[model samples]
Target: MKLLTHNMLTSKCLKGVNVGYPLGIVAKDVKVLETEFNSEFVSRIIPKLDWDTLWNAADSIGHAGDLPRAVCDDYENDVEFLKKVHHVLVEVEVIEGELVCPESGRKFSINKGIPNMLLNEDEL
Candidate 1:
């Protein structure tokens, strides 16, 4: 999954999980592919993302590149900053990994870049 997806993923659906946000990543494999950069799209999506989660996820998988810990002031107008954001948010892919819930430690396996978030009946 892309960091954009990771930034929004949550394990709150699990039983007894109050806030299952910012799921931990255990990336056994990661890939960085070239993608077309759209500055406007990156700028528009920035507000919807959790910056810390994105950074941490990228760092965990060693794909953080030059992304900053904090979104800068006037980021929309900053081309270089936007490019960096676009790379992390769009280009990096988790080829094989598991996403762990922070609250419950329940693991969701990612296969071929697709995360299996479906829970067993008991887990739900």
Candidate 2:
């Protein structure tokens, strides 16, 4: 999964969980897939992105120093920033791992880049 998606995901569904955001990345297998950069897509998605959460997830996956706070500030006319965002959001795909929620300790496993967010009956 992209770090962008990971950033938005949280354990808010978990009962009484606190600070469940920025799910801990456990990339048992990771792959960097090349994808065409689309400025419009990046610009559109920027508004929905959480800066802090995206930064934390990128840092966890060893893609730090690319994204800057100002990227969001001047997202309208920043090609470099958009490229970086595109890379973090589209290129880096986590092939396998489990994203654990910090607050509830819920484990969401990812296989072939698909996260299994289904919880057991009790967790539900």
Candidate 3:
């Protein structure tokens, strides 16, 4: 799964959890695939992203060097910064990993670039 997808995921569906957003990533395999950069697309997505969560997730997988702690005010005109954001948001892929819910500690396995987010009956 792409970091972009991971940024939007949450584990709030689990029982007794208030806010299950920003699920923790434990990546065992990571791949960086080349993607064509679109500054407009990156700029559009910046507003929707949770910057801190994205930064932490990228850091967890050892890829946060280029990401800023917060989205800068002048990001739209910053090509270099946008390129870094684009790389993290689109190019980085998690091949194998587990997404751990912060509140419940439930783990969702990711394999072959797919994250299995289905909860067991008891979990629901």
Candidate 4:
């Protein structure tokens, strides 16, 4: 899955998880696929992202150097910054990994670019 999708996912569906946001990424294999960059689209998505979580996830997969620690207030006008965000959100792909739920420590495996978010009956 792409980091953009990961930013919006959570484990809230699991039992006893009050806030399951920002599932941790444990990427075994990662790939960067080239895509046309649209600064406008990246700007639009910035507000919706959890900056800290995105930063950490990118850091985990060795792609955090270009991203700033915090999303700057004037990010919308910063072309260089926007490009970095675009690369991280759109180009980076997690081919093999596990997304760990912070609250329950549940692991969701990702294989061949597909993340298996299914939970067992008891987990529900």
Per-residue lDDT tens digits for candidate 2, residues 32-74, read 8989898999899888888777777777878765678545567
User: All candidates: CA RMSD in angstroms?
Assistant: 0.8, 1.7, 0.8, 1.1
Candidate 4 lDDT, tens digit per residue, 9-91?
99999999989888988989999999998989999999998989889989988988779999988998999999999999989
> Lowest-lDDT window of 10 residues in candidate 1?
60-69
| Clashes per candidate (backbone, < 3 Å) | 0, 0, 0, 0
- Report every candidate's CA lDDT: 0.93, 0.81, 0.92, 0.92
* Model 1 ranges off by over 4 Å: none
Residues 38-117, candidate 3, lDDT per residue (tens digit)? 99999999999988888888899999876888888899999999999999988999999999999989899999999999
Ranking by lDDT: 1, 3, 4, 2
True-structure lDDT of candidate 4: 0.92
